[model samples]
Target chain A: MTPFSHRKADTVAALGEERLISAIRRWLGDVSPPAPLGIGDDCAILPASKKAQAITVDPVIYRRHFDDSIPPCAVGAKLLKRNLSDLAAMGAKPRAAVVALTLDPRTRLDWLEKFYRGLAACARTYNLAIVGGDVAQADKILAASLTLIGEASGSRMLTRAGARSGDWIYVTGPLGGSLLGKHHRFTPRLSEGAWLAAHPEVRAMMDLSDGLAKDLHALTPSNAEPALDPALIPISPAARKLARDSKRTPLAHALGDGEDFELLFAVRKNSNRASFEKTWLRHFRQPLYCIGNFVSIGKRPAGSIDLNAHRGYEHLR
Target chain B: MTPFSHRKADTVAALGEERLISAIRRWLGDVSPPAPLGIGDDCAILPASKKAQAITVDPVIYRRHFDDSIPPCAVGAKLLKRNLSDLAAMGAKPRAAVVALTLDPRTRLDWLEKFYRGLAACARTYNLAIVGGDVAQADKILAASLTLIGEASGSRMLTRAGARSGDWIYVTGPLGGSLLGKHHRFTPRLSEGAWLAAHPEVRAMMDLSDGLAKDLHALTPSNAEPALDPALIPISPAARKLARDSKRTPLAHALGDGEDFELLFAVRKNSNRASFEKTWLRHFRQPLYCIGNFVSIGKRPAGSIDLNAHRGYEHLR
Candidate 1:
């Protein structure tokens, strides 16, 4: 049979991009499209406004980054949050996002409605716009990736490599249990990141995605660095459950489970953590922790993920 | 089985996004990252340079975009082209791109190598850099979506809606036959677009993606005021084969076979097509045509996609 003949979207229900494209054409009418072509072309190109810089992209997987029952809407919200989080991580203001969805054919419209509702609500929450996106019918499960466009003056941007060895390491919020608690609802910490970038004392920064241990390993000085304490990890209620159920240490999950969207950063050593917290901690509705400090190279394994002596998420391993 | 487990990526032996992410992490160690968080985060957040601005997104499907026989390298190139075309359409100079990959569990490392190789080649071709992307594993066919970032200065970006009545219509290279030719290789006419945008006399513009009929139909002013000559349609060599083989008219194939990545635009009635061709046409090896002109709409079926008269690729009926 010709490839096109067996091209039923249901077989690939959640994976084939063509099947999703077909479905989308029916749902999205001819968008008089402020840009050029809207849905059918290879790319969606829009005019960038002088008032706004433009975009960003955020990708996600089911088991690795989020839970399955996170509610499609919340899942949708999470995807946008993560994307906006990246812009936030860069200290950029939100503008718009386009989603590329890969899903199992079984994905009902109700699920999608909730998903968009959740995602759009978040977009509205941030005042960002959803201009366009595509959907794919997958074979068995659902997956999605979002590309967002945000605007920021060049000087306001920051990077993770900017931290000096003498800088102090600080986190925007408590960094564990993201996968266990309400990860779907976590704010991108955009304001917090932009705020920190505006503050000269904020040297280097990164969002805590793959747990404190591995992420901390990321922040260690590139030239050389001291090791961190495995015992000092702050445990979260969700992390404690991971430990209890899996029979592993809470520190392991705290350092591993991932999906923690908090910002892990370095600031000058003399900065008043309390004073900063007093002004911004209320915005997060959660607590930020100072688990360790940035130190110069010492006599230890460059730095250990310490996995609390447990394993972190490794695909091929 | 659990939701995540029920949809394990490696089910088809495609190896899924898990294995893919692992491979990429090892391949792309921290380069001079342009963003706050590089590959490891939910998204790669590039700190925007105030001097530059533009974001474009292109979603690629499996059967609709590429075939299994397509070399992995070509697949990579196709993904990049999709987004690059968007930037070209906007008359934006290409800069950076973020990829969102979703593939069946059966995908392999060998496949990824070739894919990345081709994508790398495109990056070199366009001087566009790969800033960041996300990978996910699914059950069914494979697909990818890349969001390209771009920038333009002093020039006002071009859009599809700028064409005016009595304006002369023109196309860049050849028209039709995308199925057999290097329709996949046709780069967006960004350089020409930039030149046209600089010339105020160059009215509305847009790239030909959804075939001449639909795309041109889209270019017509709202309320539909235009008359098209069926005989004016341009046919490419590849389109000749598709028509001859399919027992259809060459004009129909050119009108339906989308993916002829040529620029279809309108310029002032007095504009010199000869000079524009001399400066730009020499670079192309294909035939460019002036298919038709805009007219005041009489009752003649306000210009539109004659789906019944011509056809192109369709995902589902």
Candidate 2:
């Protein structure tokens, strides 16, 4: 038989809905505690929680998000991790997730099986339960949307709106040039975020998906603008390497190249930064940098970078 | 200007991401109690609950679920209602929701605004909060995925695994020919399902999406088979009308046509049928039909219709 015919026999269309679902369940393994109901039911039941819950939905689509160059396992892990990054930004612990997938009928069953395996591995590592999901056929393009539910670490959940003027802005690590494999494999700063949230001095926080030049706007109050010290901004090595071939500067890539997936937060300016950095180093190995502060608009420090000059990636542009 | 130029000026690409997001937020209106966070945040926070929570995710894609013939408002409402049906199946009350949308750059901004308005209306009617959302650009098709979270009606939550050998099968309303408008306009049997769940006689329940001919297998036990009565099947007038233009019989359409969005449940064999029906009639104006009962696998009722011959809609087929 030809390769096309052989692959056709292994396609999702040949497997049908029931069998495909069965395979997906097998690939996902088993549902654990905190989730009394899963997969087979119309809805998954989550155990009651006393902590406030945080929920976010994010989807990854073929061509738009990734292409065939990336492994299916990485694609699945990235789908869950992107949502995990959102919860981390809110200082929440992963709990349960439901995935909705739209796939082409010609998709190979093995590809999907591998994808679920990757997702299950990520869930296992994070102590999350893959509770339920829905699957449907698409004419073309495969997309997976993941809804992650998390419980706040404490009564205080971090948000992007509480930053005050003069708050010192910090990022968990280096940024930019995520397209060089880091976009698919980087770790979410969950513990760092939760620890920062528990700290009284940290006022507002968000994860960086879009570049700092764009995402910083979310933390800036109406009366203030973010003033960054270019020398202090930790530029990724990959970004510098990519800058060699492109017309843009390394600073431009650090400012405009999106998909950084790092934790960005503002701390009270009056707080002792030296003491806080010491405490953070003791608890975590990740590099932490205090790059800037929020200042009154039109009063930015001399020699500070102009944010509007470097725009980050925007969808549907 | 040409019609194409005028339309292009109003496309999402022209509106840009920030303006489009602002319009969506405006269309959604406001966030209320239980959900302290919405639209602008990385994650939406929901107040803690004492009761177990039900969660489900469902999506509607351009050619797969609908076409241009259906108004954008109905399409948006149907997306939420489809997920509502899943929550209703478990006897849960709607609480918070997060939506993730993927749109083509060429899609008109007005179409999206109206879609969000319809979603907002549905959310208001159901007392649900439209929490966080993510938007991404797609190459061609437009798709929306909604994740709905709900609390169980009481300590008890109905599932599809509780059916017994002698349980009686019933549906909340007529079935079939949902394409005639009911698919987009059908009322999710939320209150009726909650009532059924509260009743001690009710054993198992689910919303009928993939017609009884196939979905009945979910409630069938290993040792028992569902024996449905043809005479008692409540085929809709729409099914009869559609049958005239199609090759299938009205009964076949009733058996196999999907998207009914009606509740199907099993009641105890020994429950007082007269008293139960009386209570149902007193509370709901909708018709409740006792279609049949679960019987021994090899011992179906004499002259019972053959279920094997009629197949329901299945994705990726």
Query: What class would a CAPRI assessor give candidate 2's docking?
Result: high
Query: In candidate 1, what are the lDDT values of residues B1-317, reduced to their tens digit?
Result: 11012333433244533446556654443331434445543345544355445555666666656766567677778787766665666566777777776655555556666677777777777776676776655445467787776765336666677676666677776677876746576776767666656667667667776677666765676654455556656667888887778887777877787888777777666767677656555655554566556655554444533445655444322
Task: Please give, for residues B81-130, the per-residue lDDT of candidate 2 as tens digits.
Answer: 99999988988889988888988888887788778888889899998989
- Estimate the TM-score of every prediction: 0.80, 0.97
Query: Can you tell me the CAPRI class of model 1?
Result: acceptable
lDDT of 2 by residue, A1-317 (tens): 11112366888889888998888888888543322367888899988888889998889888877787888888889999999999899888899999999888878777787788988988888989998888988878689999999988766899898899999999999988998989989897788888999998999999999899999998898999999999988999989989999988899999888889999999999999999999999999876899999999899998888998999988777
Q: By TM-score, how accurate is candidate 2?
A: 0.97
**Residue A76 error, candidate 1, Å:** 1.4
**What DockQ values do the models have?**
0.26, 0.82
- Weakest 10 consecutive residues, lDDT, candidate 2 chain B? B1-10
